[model samples]
Target: MQTVDKALKLLEFFRTDQPEIGLSDLARLAGYDKAATRRFLVALMGHAFIEQNPASRKYRLGAAFLHFAQVREATLPLATVVTPLLDALSAETGETAHASHYSAGALIAIGIRESSRANRVHLDPSEILPLHATASGLAFLAFGPAAPLEAAVDQGLRAYTAHTITDAAALRGAVAEVRRAGYAISNQGFEDEVVGIAMPFFDSSGTATGAIAVATPASRMSDELRVLILANLHKAALAATAGIGGIPAEAFVRAHGERRAA
Candidate 1:
């Protein structure tokens, strides 16, 4: 198990921004000795999970993930169901709308739709969102599993901006607020000039499996716009949850109804 963990950890270093890395750099990033890193890389190469470029002598992710992703999508088809919701949300709010999936303690951006406006927020699909710093993450902490919040607190919250909640107690309070409201609002907590409004979507078990979020420029987030985004976000979240064969928690359904009535 430890060996498997080490190999997977090494592979995680490859991202959209740093797709290729040298051996020494891989060792530095993995915090493993050169010999250990090389051994892991060799094993991964044998499995076609990592490959080396002959010209740059740098390692890159191999093609195995493509096959795995295809198989997973063939079975789940989450993006197919979530993308339209994101698009509609973006269109309605005139902001960047994104969807995130939570699995094994990670919140990953799975779908995104950019607003047609010139000054809209941009998102990186490859970025792993911090649970305490993003609206999606906070919404998940409120409505999803408790284990992620415990894990995040154990790891210690890293403040991305001055508005980010760093203290565990404060984060708990923020999550509680999200639970009460059935959604989350982050005011430049993750980024300097962006605000995120997110609603968690649940799975069949009535536990949140992901979130749908709208990100807008702070300068453009007026009161009327906030209301507009929230209304549209609720509709999107409901459609997405139903499309994915999920059941929203009773509390979330109740809160959503109250918001709509108001």
Candidate 2:
């Protein structure tokens, strides 16, 4: 299990901005010795999870990810159901809307619909949202499984901006607020200029599986806009939850009261 974990951990470093990485740099980032990192890389290469760049001597993600992605998309199809919701939300609020999934104890962006407005926030699919720093992650922390919350706390909170909640006690309070309000809000918590709102959703088994969010420029936030976003999000969240054969968290349903499909 440890070997498998270490091997998968290597893949986490590959992101939208840094897709390829040299062996030594990957070792440093992963905190594994060069030899162990190399061994893990070699194993992953055998399965086509990572591939070496013959010219650059760096490594990038391999074709195996494509195969796995295809299987997941075909089977789960969560993104297909959520994309329209994001599009509508983005259009309604004139803000960037995104959907994310909580998988393997981490929050990963799964889809996005960018507002055509000039000052839109952009989010890339597959980007890992920090559990302590993003509204989507905070929503999950508030309403999702306790294990993920505990795991995130154990990992230590790293502040990304001055507004980020780095203390465990403060984070708990923030999550409690989310529970009371049936959604989560982050003001410059992850990105210095962004204000975001999100609500957690569940999967077919009635387990919390993901979240949806709308982000706007911090300067654009206002009480009226906040109310609009929260109202729209409640509708979209319920629709998404139903489409996925899921249900909203009991706490959220209780806080906001259940709305039937119109």
Candidate 3:
């Protein structure tokens, strides 16, 4: 188990920005000695999970992931199902709309639709959102399983901006508010001058497995705009949840239904 954990942790070190790492850097990043890291790397290479560039002597992810991703998409087609809803949400609100999937204590951006406006918020599909510092994360914490909250607290809330909630107690309060409102609003928590409004989307088990969010520039936000965004966001969330063959919790459905009716 420890070996498997170490191997998985090593893979996570490779990201969109830092796509390659030297042997020494990999050892340092993984907190393992050079010999152990090399052994792990050799094992991974054998499975075509990691490949080394001969010229730079740096390691990068191999083609296995591409095949795996293709297989997953062919089977699940989650992004295909969610993209249209995101497009509609972005069109309605004139903001950047996105969807995230909760997996292994992380919220990963999966699909996005940027507004046609020139000054729209930008998002990277590879970004792993901080659970305490984004509307998508907050909505997941409020409506999803309890393990993610505990994991976030244990990992320590690293403040990305001055508005980020760093205190565990404060984070709990924020999550409570989300639960009550059936959605979450993040104001410059993850990035300055950006606001995110999010609604949780559930899985077949009636547990929130992901979220749909609209990100807009703070300069453009207003009470009327917020209301308009929420109204469209609820419809998008419901369609996305059902499109993915998921079941929203009764409370979630009730809250949005009442809000829309009112």
Candidate 4:
């Protein structure tokens, strides 16, 4: 068990950016002797979870994780429910819509629906956004624990654009607004040229399991446009929340009725 834990620690050194690490660095990271680290890495290499660079001999994650990820994605109940909703929302609103989740303290865009309008907004799949820099992220942060939120704020809300929010007090006010309204919105906050809105979908524990959001070009997100989008957003948000399957048992019972007729 101890050896397994150490081996896993070595793998952790390779992340989204630094997807490769040398033997010496891996040894230090795992606090294991070089010889043992090499042996463990070789075993993992045999399993195809990590592969060695042909030229440098450094190690990076192999295709096994991707294979597992695909299988995992295929099994998620949300996939079936979200895709149809995203497509319908996009078709109706003529704007890009997406469903995202917060995992490992970051917002991951999991599903997308392209805008039907000639002028529209879009985000690449698998895009990761900082909690302080995006509507989906902020919606989660505002609804999530206080510690993670403050840590993210302290990590520096680097101004992404001239209009991006950087003042701590101002950002706090925005978060408060999200908490009150049960949603978050961005008008040129993350990207100066884009406007977006997001709200959380809570599981039965009242914990936010995921979020759904839509975006439009800055010009299309004007006062009148926002009104229309909000109406559509409200409908979609409620529907999405209702379909999310991970309800707490108590909440599930309440919704379905405590007693069932025979």
Tens digits of per-residue lDDT for model 4 on 1-262?
9877777667757765677889998888778889999999888888888899999999998889888877876785566677887888777777899988777667777689988777778686746766777788777776666776788778888888786778888888888777766568887777878988886666656666667888888877667766566566656656766777543223323422322221
Candidate 1 structure, TM-score to reference? 0.97
lDDT of 1 by residue, 152-233 (tens): 9999999899999999999999999899899999999999999999999888889999899999999998999999999899
At residue 34, candidate 4 shows an lDDT of: 94
Show where candidate 4 strays beyond 4 Å.
1-47, 50-61, 74-76, 246-262
Worst 10 residues of 4 by lDDT: 253-262
Tens-digit lDDT track of model 3 for 1-262:
9898898789988887899999999999889999999999999999999999999989999999999989998887779888899988988899999999998779998899999999989997768999999999999999998989988998999999999999999999999888878899999999999999999988888899999999999999999999999989888888888887899888787777777677
Task: Identify the superior model by lDDT, candidate 1 or candidate 3.
Answer: 1
List residue ranges in candidate 2 displaced over 4 A. Answer: 258-262
Candidate with the greatest lDDT versus the true structure = 1
Better of 2 and 3 by TM-score: 3
Q: Could you tell me which residue pairs clash in candidate 1?
A: none
Q: TM-score of every model?
A: 0.97, 0.92, 0.94, 0.71
Which order, best to worst by TM-score? 1, 3, 2, 4
| Greater-TM-score candidate between 1 and 3 | 1
Question: Worst 10-residue stretch by lDDT in candidate 1?
Answer: 253-262
Model 3 scores worst on lDDT over the 10 consecutive residues at 253-262
What C-alpha lDDT do the candidate models reach, one value each? 0.92, 0.88, 0.91, 0.74
List model 2 lDDT by residue over 27-145, tens digit each: 99999999999999999999999999999999999999899989998987888889899989988888999989987777888889998988878777657899889999998888887
Please identify model 1 stretches exceeding 4 Å from their true place.
none
